[model samples]
Target: MDGILVGNRLIDAGEYELAIDAFTRAALDQGLSADVLAGMGSANLGLGRVHTAERLLRDALEKDETSPEIWNNLGVALLEKGEIAEAEQVLKRAYALDNGQSDSIRDNLRLVLAKTENSVYDEPQEQDYKLIRRGSSDYMIRTISD
Candidate 1:
């Protein structure tokens, strides 16, 4: 079975508690694609494991540093950790990487900025869905891992 498929199952099962371990295992075990890293990062982020999530996300980014998805997620992790400056920087990188991904990057940037300001804006209110790092390239794994 595909690592992404299995990872998605764990995520849907709300077993994110175990999904990271599973994803990490699958990725390393199979020498899988960047999707594996994305899944692991997502699971860790769900568990509020920012550092781990960042690591995984970085791995994904290193595989494809130009991917807006990776940059956006790194920004989100930094944002949630109250690293607004870092978050903004990542967001900018994401936006610069792909203008086509502007919506996601903008939304993520808005969320972090709002949190920083504690401003009352129309939040997404989509609790189950969050900004996860995805779509990184295989090449990005090396640089991001470091």
Candidate 2:
């Protein structure tokens, strides 16, 4: 199987370390392609290495700016790191690039909007914002009101 494909499968299975290794092998074999970089970033994000993930994702974006998946992944990393504003913009771009066809992107956008509103209002209530990972590279933020 292709290293990137294996890496993506490992990511879907939550084997982030294995995914990273797979992505690394893919990078070595493929000369640091955008897909390899994005796979590496996704694995890093799964491992909670936000800085590394952000850097790799940014690099991936530089290589291929038209990929909504990379933008969404970057947005998720930013959101997890509490960079809500940038997350919102990144997710917005992802949504636009996807033509609003992806539910995961839409959910992420909703999450960003909720976070932005929460920050803007400066009101602390009983709302739980949960970041839910969906499938291989999709994320959904569930808001539970208490």
Candidate 3:
């Protein structure tokens, strides 16, 4: 459980690579639990590997369907993949499962709702560039317009 705790803290600190390592170590040592799978899924999500994250979260859910955190992370993976409708439904499920106790889940649900509302009238457009952040804690998203 110590490794899982370390992995969780690493994830919260935004050290995704290190968190993955920690979770991997935990899985090797104590076997894969739903918590470990969720931590790895969340780490992959933070690394922008949405498909991998989704897969991992799904596996975690199969092991423990009652986990709100797993559902929330799965919803985030779907959201990042642009499956807004499915993301909204999954996030709402997470919110309901958790009894609306998680602010992050609520915020993510709101974000999906807002995006879905905006996408109704806006045609799909190709994006030339995307904003990326650097460093730890302190970060910024700069748009490089063509």
- Measured by TM-score, the strongest candidate is 2
- Cα misplacement distance, residue 30 of candidate 1 (Å): 3.2
lDDT per residue as tens, model 1, 8-118: 677666678677667767877776456777677767776778899889898887676767766776777776665767887887787778774556566666655655455
TM-score, per-candidate, Cα-based: 0.67, 0.89, 0.81
By lDDT: ranked, best first: 2, 3, 1
Angstrom error of the Cα, residue 107, model 2: value is 0.1
Candidate 1 TM-score versus the reference: 0.67
Each prediction's number of clashing residue pairs: 8, 0, 0
Which candidate number maximizes lDDT?
Answer: 2
lDDT of 2 by residue, 43-103 (tens): 8887889899999999999999999989998999898777889999999999999999989
Better of 2 and 3 by lDDT: 2
Each candidate: RMSD:
8.6, 2.3, 5.1
After superposition of all CA atoms, the RMSD between model 1 and the true structure is 8.6
**Candidate 2 error regions (>4 Å):** 124-131, 143-146
Ten residues in sequence with the least summed lDDT for candidate 1:
137-146
